[model samples]
Target: MLLAPLALVAACGGGDKGTQEPPSTTAVLVDTLFTFPSQWSSPQLTLKAGGTVVFMFEGGIAHNAIFRLNPGNPPLAGAPADIPPTVNAVVRRTFATVGTFPVNCTIHPGMVSEVVVVP
Candidate 1:
């Protein structure tokens, strides 16, 4: 739990407070950029305990998004699987736990960020 908070839904878009959705169904987008601030979605993502995260590779180069135990360390004990590399690719992942989650681009090292999920 290094950072994504899904515990990771998007700041805006989708779901209702109490109508029929728990807000956990909301989706957030993190663009894979090749420059500074690699992840333009947010340095810190705040998501509901059962929210979703959409990793959008909208940058020039190919990129992959993965939820890691320790940034770039691959395959944690309990975490979402890694998103493969591709340009203009879209990955939608849902988190069922309430904790901090870390996301990184497998192809592009040093592109790291965190998401926080609140109860």
Candidate 2:
């Protein structure tokens, strides 16, 4: 009867929350040679905590994406043991913690970028 319809409505409305929102995605374009545009030309990125940042290289000269392990710490001259030699091609790195990470190129030295994770 009418009670049955009301019960069904209540059950549907009070049931577990709808599917959680999907994690946001951020893109960093790596251009040819020693440059990655300061900002997005199209489809600007909005990063959040625990988000994924993808470095899409577009005909670059074997560029790399190396992030500083520690922001407060000073930059070291040589490469750290943990960081791989390079991060060429499409590279995806997740930011679980919230902070500003300084990224740079190992081969070109001048090329640099950053991944800022907000909580």
Candidate 3:
């Protein structure tokens, strides 16, 4: 009797777990001067207007991400604060405004990437 009840419960709990949504993606950044030739894990990333992106700084290296204020990219209303020079830091930013955001590392020259937000 117990085996039959257990079998019924297991059958009732059967559903395709593959239909679930995948885990959120994140970007990893490291100091190019010491780690890799390029600092960015990806040159560019696109996200929805309300989506969030996580930036992971590799350990044992001083790295910071600053949103550059240039001609096209003045300032974003919902941009994350500039990441300070840290050995290992994790920053999350929500893209509320739809625009192209340019990120750079002040410690390393030629280290740059862009994040595009769409509607």
Candidate 4:
């Protein structure tokens, strides 16, 4: 009985080991609007500036992300920041600007999501 207990403890590697931290960014699953009520997993996501938002799609109906920017919220610097129609793929977008971005999937009307980036 003593040997079995000791073996169990050893197997667990009992020690003050530092725990690993989770990744900074989180993924949002894109679902079919026809079957599901919503498009993105989360309707709205708020994160600090520089944080990344990952959109993951798993086959089936296609989808995309189009950001609606206005004078108050200018377009993202560099290349067009819209995620093209994609399926069974993962797309990542980093929010460096501090503003509210309204995203929608043109493929499916009323399929909308929002992301707010704060300082």
Task: Note the residue pairs that clash in candidate 1.
Answer: 3-101, 3-115, 4-101, 4-115, 5-8, 5-115, 5-116, 5-117, 7-49
lDDT of 4: 0.65
TM-score of each: 0.59, 0.47, 0.60, 0.60
Error of 1 at 10 (Å): 33
**CA lDDT of 72 in candidate 4?**
38
lDDT (0-100) at residue 21 of candidate 4?
A: 32
Write model 4 residue lDDT over 1-119, tens digit each, in one string.
78999898889765556774334464222222221334677678876676677777655668877787432365555213887787777777777777787777777777787887666
Per-candidate Cα lDDT values, in order, are 0.62, 0.49, 0.65, 0.65
Between prediction 2 and prediction 4, the one with superior TM-score is 4
Residue range with the least summed lDDT across 10 consecutive positions in model 1? 28-37
Flag clash pairs in model 4: none
lDDT of 3 by residue, 80-102 (tens): 66667766666776666777877
Report model 4's TM-score to 2 decimal places: 0.60
Tens digits of per-residue lDDT for model 1, 9-107: 564446665575445544333323232335545565776666677766675667776778554375654457777776766667766667777877756
What residue runs in model 2 are displaced by over 4 Å at the alpha carbon? 1-46, 69-88
